[model samples]
Target: MTISLKYRIALVVFVLQVAIFSPLLWFTFTAYRDADLQQLQTREDVFMRLVSQLGRKALLTAEPTDFQLFIAPFSKDSHINRIILLNQSGIVVASTAPVDLGGPLPVQKNERNTVWKTSEIANATEQLGAITVHFSRAELDKKVEALVKRGIPIAVAGIILSALVGLGLGSLLTRRLKALEQATRRMGAGDMEVTVAISGNDEVAHLAQVFNEMSGSLRSQFDELQQVQQELSFQAQHDPLTGLPNRLLFDLRCSQAIATARQHKQLLALLFFDLDHFKNINDSYGHQVGDAVLRCVAARLTMALKDHNLIARLGGDEFCVLIEQLEQEQEAAAVAESVLHMLTVPLECEQHEFFLSASIGICLYPRDGDDEVRLLRNADTAMYRAKAAGRGGYRFYSHEQTSSVQERTSLEQRLRKAIERGELRLNYQPQVCLTTGNLVGVEALARWSSPEFGLVAPEKFIPIAEESGQILAMGEWILDDACRQMQKWRRDGSTIPRVAVNLSALQIQRSDIATLVRRTLDSTGLPANCLELEITEGYILQDADRAVAVLQQLRDLGVSIAIDDFGTGFSSLSYLHRLPIDRLKIDKSFVQEIGSTSRAAQVAQAVVSLGKTLGLSIIGEGVEQLHHANALREWGCHEGQGFLYAPALAPDQLHLLAPFKRLP
Candidate 1:
């Protein structure tokens, strides 16, 4: 029902035409009628004048022929209906009406009231002196009728043309508005394919242009939002550093695998892998090095497993692998072994080489409770059991192993309590010079005088210490105990031998190691020269720069540095030349076969030559026989530590060492 602008304009124009022309048309018709009437009256007057002239000529000359001449001219005027002449007595002399012309103007009707004289005329000749004229009014009435008939058709044609123009314009404008409405609806429903087709320099066309631009902008924004959403989803399910599936993704895969295994009556195995002493690597190196190590581990695990198998990082040093559609448990074990072997090889990072290892635990579906949570927990328990069986190995989930895991877990809890109970003590093993038979140094060894466990082995507890980050505390206690022993030796008028304390990978890589060492030496009032820090060669080779810096700081404090288990590493003389080392302790593996095999003798001789060239002393450890000692001395090794001389002893056992003769 809405009206378009063109229709409304046309309607207004029509209304104005009617308002103005109705009265004008009425006036024109009246004027036209009056003008025709006036023309008729003028024609009648001329004819009457001609009649009067003829009658007057006849009266003046007494000639009827003159009258005939003028009357003939008047009769030729076609617009006149009749003409008549009347005397002063009101008698018609000549008449266009036949009856009125021949006799006295019989009673004059209102239409024929134009007479020559009225009642004022008296004498017969004066009053009856006649002038007659005649004319017809029918011609004037026909002319006015002709004008009205011609005007009516033209008016009708004009109205029809105006309507057609209005309709055409209205249709064009309304269609554009309709198209705009449709496009708006489509855009509202999230479709940008619709476009309003309006081409002109008018307002509606401009509106259409704006609408198209709006749709384009909205579509672009929607696309960008979708991309951002996808990126967020990727980050949520994947580890940012390793680009591997994270725990959330792992859980989802685990659930799906479990469901499929149940349906097929097959088994799914979940392998939980924990990096052995991974934190010690971080503590010995830096977190940057730790991240690199993790990336390397992830790469190795990925390569070991098949494409269908799933591997995911469960955060930190923990990762999980799911083996689906496996034929047997051995298949999963084979994969775990491959991972273990590949990871055990040295990982080279920024010129530092590291021998990384993993402890793997396997749990099977249906047997380990076919659920994600149960599988994950069982796998974790089996992994700890693997670590307990000595790390860099794998263990399968069994109900029997549960008791052992619980016992180990309980032992860890008690070990924490032991520190508070002050049950831990230190023992010292003498480092004897092979040639001089003098006690050159002592290696401080930690022992747990546990009230419950009685005595615990270092191998059993040190892994626990490394895992729980309690090694830092245990290391601190060792330092304190060693410094105290040095102070006691000095107070008793005995010359103080250099006390070598082993530093865990974590302890030596600490940035504040220098401060901690200085404080420990100060607190015990032990001379810095009497303290020697023994670090494993594996940790030092991981980051030579960091290791050298820490060693230099210790050296600057008047303390000595030695690389323990030196021969077993990828020992490059280039790195050794850069290290501020005072001694190189040959690993027990080489020392055990010394003087027994040519290969062992050659390794021992090479180490002695390398140590002498680097201006570092060589100490051979685990020399259990006299020939072992004699061989090391002949090889020019400076010191030897073995059971042949003395085992690591308690503080109270020092008197027994005093009575025994020193080794030659």
Candidate 2:
């Protein structure tokens, strides 16, 4: 609805031209009419003066013929349609149009006539008659009409000429303004790059220049902010070091992958991998080398997986792989195997060769577990199982494995609330002298009585605690409670030697184990020698040097280390010497078949002999039958604990589990 500047400028010029010329044309007509009237009056005056002189003689002594002669010129000159002359007697003497020759000029003015009158007197002041001259205005009217007729066309033509000239100038000036207007419109529509081509030095041109400058500045600023936003967005989801998706992004991708596989009715796998011996590598070389190895591993994984799978680094040498659209569940094993093969290629960093291998555990959708957390946890548990078997391979989760994983998850959830719910308690199983059946010590066992599940076995939930990293807290709690119970028994005057508490590999791995032990003894007011620490051979020999250092550090505090479930692990005999092991408890499987000529019974006999040769105390677990205890005593086993003597009893029922020889 806007009027363009081109037409507006033309309209202004046209209006100005009309305003100036109208007044000039009107004044021209008025001036011409006034000059013509003045000339006519002068001519009439001169003729009248001449006629009055001639008429004086006629009036005084001559006849009407002389008056007629003077008046005849007036009629022929066309200055008058009628002329009149009057004598001193106040009567008309002559006239140009001779109607009455002396009619006294009719005594009135006429609409069509121009009249002039003058007085005639003698030289000495004598009174004389007045003479009046009459002339017709028809000729003056004709000239005024002619001038008006001629000037009208000229005025109109001048107006039109001014309009064309104005249009030409306006178009030339407004062209740049139109360009600026277009540019402004584009900028309003979010086009910051829009600019005008300014050519002139007028105000419009200057305005266009400023607009271009502003557009450039806005474009520059917009680009900078856009780049910054992109960088921030990328950094939020990516690992800056490996440039891989972090845990948060991995979870998102996992959810998406699950949804996609579900929609397509296909199977997918989630693989969780942890580098074997990574910590040892970090300790051997330096952190820089470790970082280099991690980066190299990431590169190798990326190359191996390509676009067929989603790979992410889940922090600290742990990585996850998501394989989608799997036609067969076995495809997951192939992907995992390829990853293992890729990682096995030794990495040479800083002129030193570093060997890398990973343990990968796979959980397939609709088979192992469903949700992201369940899938991730299942894969991690399977990974730990793979580590238990042997490193440097892949494992596809089985149904039993999945059930175990679920049980672990459920147990962990319940165990976290166990202390608050008062479901966890220590049951002391008495250890007796194998020969005389006298009590030597007691091993504290943890029992969970869940309101929902009833009595759950320790074997089921203990491994769950170890895998979930809750064992550290559970171990500390057990030690504190066991030490306190031992002190209580002492106050009640019991002769029990020591109270033994079991430790997991996770507990042994901590540098704070000594501190935890010391704090527990100090808080419970129990002597360090009365609180025994038990660990599995498999766990202790995993990192022989670290375990030795840790166990010796505890032994230096007056606490003893007993190897539990001996003859079951692939423990090197040298580890026994390295470790300050004070005792060895024969594995229960070996003691069950003690009387039989079974390999298990022979292994138990060998273990008892090994403990004797090493000058360490030996005990037997799972001693159920009289012959089992007799066989252990014959094998030189110093002590035993199992159902044959008594089941684990509560603190107040220690008298029920009182040490006595087995009834025959």
Best by lDDT: 2
Would you list the C-alpha lDDT of every candidate in the order shown? 0.78, 0.81
Question: Residue by residue across 153-212, what tens digits does model 1's lDDT show?
Answer: 655655665566556666666778878888899888878667777899899999999988
List candidate 2 segments past 4 Å from native: 1-19, 35-67, 73-77, 110-131, 153-178, 232-300, 312-327, 340-407, 420-443, 449-455, 467-469, 485-497, 504-515, 534-556, 561-664
Candidate 2, which ten residues in sequence have the lowest lDDT sum? 121-130
Quote model 2's TM-score: 0.70
**Against the true structure, whose TM-score is highest?**
2
lDDT comparing candidate 1 with the true structure: 0.78
| lDDT tens per residue, model 2, 1-664 | 9877787898898888888888988998899899999998887778777766776667666375766776677677655565565666666677776784656556555565565466473335544455566567888889988997898788879888879867977887887877888888888898878889886788988898898889899889878888999988788888887898988888999998888888888888899999986764564445787888888888888888897668899999899998888889778888888988887787877776766788989898978888899899889888876875678888877767766666656778999888778899999999998776678899999999998778999977786677567777888888889999999999999999999999877776654889889988888899988988998887654556777878888999999899999988768777787789799999999999987878988899999999999999999999999899888888788999999887888988888864374531
State the lDDT at 291 in candidate 1.
93
lDDT value for model 2: 0.81
Q: CA shift at 486, candidate 1, in angstroms?
A: 1.9
Clashes of 2: 3
